[model samples]
Target: MDVQKTEIWDTKMVPRMSQFRAFQQVLDRTHSHWDLKNSNDDHYTAEVRRHTVNDFVFTELAADPLTGNRTISDIRQSDHHYFCLLYLEAGDGVLRQGPNESKAAAGSIALWDSTRPAFFGTHSQFHQFSLLIPHEVALQSLPGIEDLCGLNVDGNEGTGALLLSHLRQLHDTIDTIDTQDRPAILRATVDLMAAAFRPSEEKIGGTAFRRALLTRVQEHIIENLGEPDLGPQNIAAAFCFSPRYLHRLFNQFDMTVSDWIKRSRLFRSRSDMETPYLDGLSITQIAMKNGFKDSSHFSRVFKQEFSMSPRAYRNQAHNLRLS
Candidate 1:
């Protein structure tokens, strides 16, 4: 099979600098005493004595990939950073604000939002792994996720340990992961990562429900590509989703769900034209039967897509077969 990219920046740094700039942003704020190393083709680390000294280290480590570099305040109120998705492979401490103290250690995941000031201080040396996903991707995995920004993913045991183990595996093997498994791994990471941060039973069930619902929609789309009634409302009602949330899923793919339905239908129609056994069916009849109300519109769209009308496409295929 032709290779798909699953390139790792840690494993390939010379040309990967551009690819890894965004990942580097998560470590922006290391205190002055922290050892520093920045080079084009080198593995870098941002180590510190505690997880909760300050949150400013993130933007400094990042510089500026999406938003401006977050500045370190002289008299910081938050022992933690303003905005971050914090994960630790190993460490221990208590992050404090007012009367609440969030436990920090290995197997822990916590989200800090810059939108609100917060604090979490690791009492001792901390080992950290983190990411600065775009605000858009963040919301995709956790709709209305802003509500849980300051909350810590409880990590004493169970699913939290499972997620922590996965992170450890990812960190250890970031050097050598197969390319084809990359997308699935990334998606699984997003699912488990979100799970680590929220412990509410209701929230977990909700995430699972959405994931299952989307999977079913995908199955329906593939199975009934020719039925035009497969429009947004029917889909939304079938899956018990609001059309708005349905749009969000399509938005992730840079398509309107309706547009994808039409595109899929047209592709299937064109494929049908090439079948010699179906020669008894005229191209116009095939188009009309496969969800096209206006054959002229179908012709225009098909020609624009394939650079030939449906009839020409069939003729070209037929000639190629006889030759």
Candidate 2:
């Protein structure tokens, strides 16, 4: 992330979270469970740049506290073991910080810069939503925050909550962020975040339509996977595409209309087979749901692809799931 260039991605959803967890190395962040008791990995990636440092803040409140007793997972960067504003927001519960412990409930904010270390303790399950923004982004306006660096901003009201509300909204709508509108959204959000620190907003740029269009297309496919009529022609019609033009799109993936839909149905059926939630769905029923017409044909195709009959596989899955 070159501070000179502008790039904003909302890597803030469960799918992105799984990807980040799978590839924490991209984050280049480090974490330390440098306090008392039970131990675990100090580092984990929360997003591309932002990291979550679990109990590091809480350790300040108490080495031992009243609660279910918690463990801190350092969600942070490998570079800059220290940061200016180590902010945290709670999805729920009472979080103790500084001289007074406050409940962040929902839509609340807490700020902590590196200089004066802050500690926190949460009652019940201490799940935290945190961000490690760049020092440049944090200290943009409140240079005096050097003195107030580690102090908690009363994010329960006014500017802080407003900023938090924005963060929460972005976090919630991440998967649905339209690429066509992303540049505008990223620009506005960056400016809004900058302004929250009461700093002059940074000049953000726009996105190219080509990339945005591709994103829009992928989103369409993912959202409509279950539509039995979601063949290339159907999709093309929905997108106002000519059949020939739609065939060109599938050609990129080296498949024609029918093959693509068949493979897609197989994949969805395979995914469902892994879950007990589909226990009531007979193999034929599941296949029919995904557009397969005949149970015997469905079984043969499934067995060839997965090395097992659909019922045998479903039974195995159910047994394993039970275990």
RMSD for all candidates, in order, please: 14.2, 18.1
Report the error of model 2 at residue 33, Å. 34
| Poorest lDDT segment (10 consecutive residues) of candidate 2 | 55-64
Where does candidate 2 stray beyond 4 Å? 1-215
In order of appearance, the predictions have TM-scores of 0.42, 0.34
Question: How many clashes in each candidate?
Answer: 12, 13
Each prediction's Cα lDDT score?
A: 0.54, 0.46
Q: What lDDT score goes with residue 12 in model 2?
A: 47
- lDDT tens digits, residues 121-235, model 2? 4443233444444343333222223333323444557666666677666655643655466445544554554445441212112223432443355456556666766766677
Score residue 227 of candidate 2 by CA lDDT. 70
What is candidate 2's CA lDDT for residue 235?
A: 72
Overlapping backbone residue pairs in candidate 2 total: 13
Candidate 1 wrongly placed segments (more than 4 Å): 1-84, 89-101, 114-117, 198-235, 238-323
